[model samples]
Target: MKGIRFWAFWPVAYQPSSLQASQPPSLFGLIGRRMTKGQRRKLNRIYFMKYCSNCGQPVIHRTPPGDDRPRFCCESCGMVHYLNPKLVVGCIPEMEDRILLCRRAIEPGYGKWTLPAGYLENGESVAAGAKRETLEEARAKVEILTPYALYNICHVNQIYLMFRARLKDKRFGAGAESLEVKLFGENDIPWEEIAFRVIHATLLKYYDDRRLGRFSFHMENISPPNPNPPKTDN
Candidate 1:
């Protein structure tokens, strides 16, 4: 479960060329000017099986290596495949001075708490994704308050957007993805049992922002720890 979640939600990091020049090159780069055509082809084949980041289609084959660049051709839509970040959206919904949270019933963080969140669906706006996740996980309607936190999980390669929201009514229950649904004041939140670093960070930010009566948005990159972090899903 942890492995699956790590691959699904974590962000992948690429060292910038400028940064690389300042430090020792990786073993692969040290041996060559660039990835060899054969190496790029192999990488492309692996990438295609992971699906087209653009159209969600399984890329059928590697494109002919061209100009020493990696390329893949999608079979479903004939689109070129290029690695890109996937967008995820979530919301922290507040009602009566408490924040809504869900206990995930699925792995990576089974039994751990999280804000309602999931990947953005095709043709959906970020806000729509947030709303949909809220409904899907908590069975509640909420009004978006403001942008909250934006984070890049670079270990697996995902961009997360969290929105501050106000519950339309104090009416919600556990939905498909959740084992339980409840609200918690800051002091009562299960800090050590939270699902992910991003969620923990977001909750911290929310508390600070609420106390100051000031709302501001920020972004950060979160790296997963080595040796496989503990699972939080129920």
Candidate 2:
């Protein structure tokens, strides 16, 4: 389990980039240009399987007979494991002049403000997942309008899908994963204390679009902080 009830609802396999193979940590490293040893270790523990799902045999990390890349393989049962990126779904829930937000009661940014969002469930639609996260974290009901932002955070092997929505009503409270639930006007937002870069980026765009009187889809690759980068998706 991706504990703490934060954004990381599920564990994902971490694959080191071949391009980042042996370079020293540099400015580009902050942007996922390279995978550090710590990064490799963090992912391996969560994603590397020890036992074959097909059988009760221990698995080995190796390339298959004809495969070029390394994989988790079971010699006894001939099972192979492949990993992929994860999808994080959430929404920007808005009322008349404010946006609904949750102060996380979980780690990976405990007690900080954030949009209502979480991991996309295996079978849930993207918009449905966003709505679910909104209701789950803020106890706010919302009707999703349109996708507002998409972030390709390659550094973390995760993608973010954020939607713009209209809050059903003003009635809301903190859910299990939040310390407090509140509505924030753009000027009142906790810019310095916001949880993640992607959240900050999304909010910035939302406010900008509002001023422009036109909302358009936004896509960007987020870069990690150069120093003391905060944990993102657990």
lDDT string for model 1 (1-234, tens) is 222211111112221221223233343352323454544543333333446677876554333435234344565776765667889899999997899999999999999999999999999989988999999999999999889899988666799999999999988999999999999998999999999989999999989988999989988988766657688999
What lDDT tens digits, residue by residue, belong to model 2 across residues 22-114?
A: 333442233333445555444444445767788978766556767676677677878887767889999998899899889999999998999
Whole-model lDDT values for every prediction:
0.77, 0.80
Candidate 2 versus truth, CA RMSD in Å, comes to 8.9
C-alpha TM-scores of all predictions: 0.70, 0.77
Q: Candidate 1, which segments miss by more than 4 Å at Cα?
A: 1-69, 74-79, 228-234
Instruction: Report the number of the highest-TM-score candidate.
Output: 2
> Compared to the true structure, candidate 1 yields what TM-score?
0.70
Prediction RMSDs, each to the true structure: 9.2, 8.9
